[model samples]
Target: MKIKLLFFFIVTLISLSANAQTEVADQPAGLEGLISSRTAQRKNPDAKMDGYHILIIFDENRSKAEAIRNKFIAEFSNKYDADVIWDEPNFKVYVGVFKTKLEAQELLNLVKDNYPTAILVKDKLKFPKI
Candidate 1:
């Protein structure tokens, strides 16, 4: 009986081991070439996409814009991101990286009481992490 039990156990183990082998799926044609070409070209690390931001302040004075940016950072930095961009002669202060105009509008509505002139501006935005 012990001999029969041991033989059954060995047979089960062998069968299980045999079934454990995985088969590799066939790669589609041109996938390897595409991957190689992509690797050669190299992707941008800081990839940006078309998005919207709340234009909080746009002024000709850099100092004024910087001051408003600092104020915004102090008040709402936890909720949103803020930046002071130099667009030629004027300094523009923007907030939030919204993927859609509706999302930007939502935040804009909330902040409208404080910044009455806040409007949504479409621009390149940092890609969100998964």
Candidate 2:
């Protein structure tokens, strides 16, 4: 009778441990699903599309252009919440998608201090649909 009780206790402990582990394992899938769904929503442009737009043109031949681009990204990433992208033939950096030209111009003035040669241009920004 004592041996039978010990065996039953071991089995109960193992079953309880297995159930606890399953509950913990189940948590990450829900969190991962939430993250993946949010990412999918962001990929849907129709879900959210409205912001400032600005273009920055850099000297393609200048070696310092890359350094300048990095600096601009570091400095403005949080302050202005800008997006910097590299377009072929030139390192094209763009800030927010402003509703009006004036708003873009204002941001240009703020960023130009760091990048003296940076100038504003008109070009449509493109990002791969996620």
Candidate 3:
């Protein structure tokens, strides 16, 4: 049938192309080179680690979220950084990167006065600052 002939032709072309390949390495440059280099560097050490944090505020409004983040930054006596995360229905204001729930709770206790509903939330934690 004509269908059988077409299938044979396709297989023949694929086999021909497959056999005509070389083992030449790619010369990635610019952005690709930068990405490859960074990934290679990460292989030796952790670029970041998964951890926990304390949620200072969860607000649907962007302005409220910014206000909470700014308030914590101004009043917090610790070295932890506060960041606003946008997740679906709300913006979360998270402060500090703790390796354990206990560590997060310690921070939560300190922030309870300012953020009454503050609680520990597990999330990705960045490497400790040098």
Candidate 4:
């Protein structure tokens, strides 16, 4: 019984030692540069831009869009990112940066009464270049 147990312990130790091997791989030339470039891309803060935003209103008149934005800001206690983007003939007023559609939907329900046409849109938002 002792001989069997001793043999079992030796086998287990040998198996464990054999399994503990360092991982190493050889890559083609230029692969290291590609790998570093990929890391650099991930390190950039602005690489990720998928976020849900609410389009408060769209109008051909810039003044109308600005007025709506101001009114919305004045009435709402929370601060929102307000921007006017020209989409062809019309200027779009977008507000708020929500990480998910569910979050935007919750706010949309509340703001819908004020801006009946307000809808959620996926906008790629980046931190303004400082």
Candidate 5:
């Protein structure tokens, strides 16, 4: 019985040791560049990404822009994120953070009749909410 238990313990230890070994694969050539780029991006929290947004209102009056933004928010509910940005003389109402123009165009098509002047504008956009 003592010999049998010792044999079982030895076999278990050998199996565990064998299973502990890990195989390493060669990293891709571009992996270092990608890692460095990601590290740089992480270091800059305010770094903006180039993307598209649907421009709903571009008016010189702040009140009018706010009114339009309110109307859009009421209509769309919580379906999108809307913002009223002041750019010098004009206050702009931009909607959605889209990675591609096609995505912005899709929303624009749905919004076109309500806002005839709505158009896709290429700009620095916020990251989409998780």
Candidate 6:
């Protein structure tokens, strides 16, 4: 009876250890498969630009332009999430690539209020290679 009890205890410990090992081994494979699937989805180039693009112009002088750029960044950073591009002759600040012209117009209105000098220009605005 003593030998039987010892064997039973050893068998139970071994089964528990095996179960724990299986669980540990399965977790990483599951995570890796998920990661690989997500990577594959991102690798597909079916993504298209279905959004609106706006062009903005700001004065590009040494003192005034710097101040305007700083002010625009501080003010619209959270509001419109603008992407500012500084050209040599002028400081051009472009806002979001909105999904609709109305969205761009809304941002233009806001910009007009903040920077009254700002103008809504054509989307064909170009920036020199930086």
- Which candidate leads the pack in TM-score? 5
* lDDT score for residue 117 of model 1: 83
Error of 2 at 120 (Å): 2.6
lDDT of 6 at 67: 61
The TM-score measured for candidate 6 stands at 0.43
What are the runs in model 6 whose C-alpha is more than 4 Å off? 1-56, 121-130
Q: How does residue 49 of candidate 1 score in lDDT?
A: 80
Q: How far is candidate 1 from the true structure (C-alpha RMSD, Å)?
A: 4.2
The collision pairs in model 6 are: 52-98
Error of 5 at 45 (Å): 3.3
Tens digits of per-residue lDDT, candidate 3, 31-123, equal 787988877755645666778888888989999999988878888654788889999899998899877788888888888987799988876
Per-candidate local distance difference test:
0.86, 0.61, 0.83, 0.85, 0.88, 0.62
Better of 3 and 4 by lDDT: 4
Off by over 4 Å in 2: 1-52, 57-66, 81-86, 125-130
TM per candidate? 0.64, 0.42, 0.60, 0.62, 0.73, 0.43
Task: Write one digit per residue (lDDT tens) for candidate 4, span 44-109.
Answer: 986656789899899999999888888888877546777788898998988888878998899899
Residue ranges of candidate 4 with Cα displaced over 4 Å: 1-48, 127-130
Pairwise TM-score winner, candidates 5 and 6? 5
Better of 2 and 5 by TM-score: 5
Stretches off by above 4 angstroms in model 3 are: 1-47
Query: Could you say which candidate leads in lDDT?
Result: 5
lDDT per residue as tens, model 6, 1-130: 9999999999999999887744433465579889987677556555333455455555565566556556777876655545556677776666655656787778778777666656554453222222
